[model samples]
Target: MANSTTLSTGKTFAWGGGKSPFSVSYGKLMMWIFLLSDAFTFSSLLIAYGFIRYSYQAPIANTIIKPLQHVGENFVEEMKKAGLFVQDHWPAPELVFNHFPFIHGMHLPLFFVSLMTFILIFSSVTMVLAVEAGHRMKKDEVANYMLLTIIGGAAFLGCQAWEWATFIHEGARLDYNPFGPRSFAALFFIVTGFHGFHVFSGVVLNVIIYLNVLAGTYEDRGHYEMVEKVGLYWHFVDLVWVFVFTFFYLI
Candidate 1:
């Protein structure tokens, strides 16, 4: 016999445990579990980065130039002369990531990366709007928002590729770094590459879901839970980027 409990109004409820106690679907629950594990992985990577970065001496201050100041092609050599880009000290992120598309020889510290961050955060917003449209069973709205989200993600990827190209052109490599320590370039590549891969995967998934929405698949299924699930993944990716930005750029 199953156990039962009486409510205050004298209604009886059985403790037969076939259903989820948390009232969540098995698929959603599994997605949560996977996200939890992924969170642990990202946490481990960031923690490792933090440990290694703190082990090095603090970054040297830049007192010579201000933003928008014209710099010569020998900027890296100059920074080296100023002791700002030495193996013994961490490179200041502003000096390392100052270039922008179509802009040359100007000290625009952190400007491009800030734009990338904005693009990603805006995509996350579109994702939320998409999920909300899904809740209302508005297929067209969901598709539109999803498309915007995909475009935003693609733009971010393109920016990242450009940034990587610029860094490589300036002589950043796994084994060699003109910046500070070799580990700096290596870790930057590893962490940002990993995050970029996730963004790419999320974009692919969004495309598939968008197509399914156009085909009325979720409409036939009478729910938009798939969109919600993918939204969870997308939001997680965005949140991880926040931490990565803080650690890599702001710190």
Candidate 2:
């Protein structure tokens, strides 16, 4: 039976039997609330991107030949071999993300970025395994999975740094771009940069929690709720990246 109490006003209030009103811990509930708010923020950015892109559909007459470095050597060569030049136009995402790090001057459309996406998705899988292991009280398995998750998050952040450098080197700026629209440059940097910062912060949190796990802190506490909480955050980071990849790259 639910616990009920009578107030002076003759109103009865019934309470659920648990540490938390809903059966979820305070930490997990707060994390969900945070993720919900963050989702709205990202949605707004993407909605703005779509609106601006659609509204600015008019072609500008000040077209210039695309820089040789911007489209990679192989892309330019293919155009040349076909007796053509890379004319300026609304930037195609495939062409924009064509180059891979360390293998520059090659046309490998979205290759490295695809690899980064796989890394983040794989990290999410490891996060799940970590949470599962925590439930099973398998400390070693949890540690290993958490380690892999941290590495994946770190690698994604490093890749973002390199990508940002390549973009700026190719002449994309807040108010200037070799691409057609200035708003595109501004939005690209703001949206992706914000996401990258979140990934970096997640990695740091994972490392701290991993160390605590290794120290047997949770074991003494009789539960690995900390791991589960961090997993929620890591999963949210990965989920956000999915929308970013789809909206910014695939679209």
lDDT of 1 at 192: 95
- Show where candidate 2 strays beyond 4 Å: 1-21, 58-89
- Clashing residue pairs in candidate 2, if any? none
Query: In candidate 1, what are the lDDT values of residues 1-251, reduced to their tens digit?
Result: 13345558866544435556556888899999999999999999899899999999989988998999998898999999988899999999999998999999999999999999999999999999999999899999999999999999999999999999999999999889999888999999999999999999999999999999999999999999999999999999999999999999988
**Residue-wise lDDT of candidate 2 within 1-251, one digit each (tens)?**
23545568866544523235556888899999998999999899988887776666433332333433344344534543443322333456766677687875655667888999999999999999999999998889999999999999998998999999988887789987665667878999999998998898899999999999999999888889999998998998899899889877876
The superposed Cα distance between candidate 2 and the true structure at residue 17, in angstroms, equals 6.6
lDDT of 1: 0.92
Q: Judged by lDDT, which candidate is best? A: 1
> For every model shown, what is its TM-score relative to the native structure?
0.94, 0.83
Q: What is the C-alpha lDDT of each candidate?
A: 0.92, 0.80
Indicate the residue-level lDDT of 150 in model 1.
94
Model 1 spans > 4 angstroms off? 1-16
What's the alpha carbon RMSD for model 2?
A: 5.3
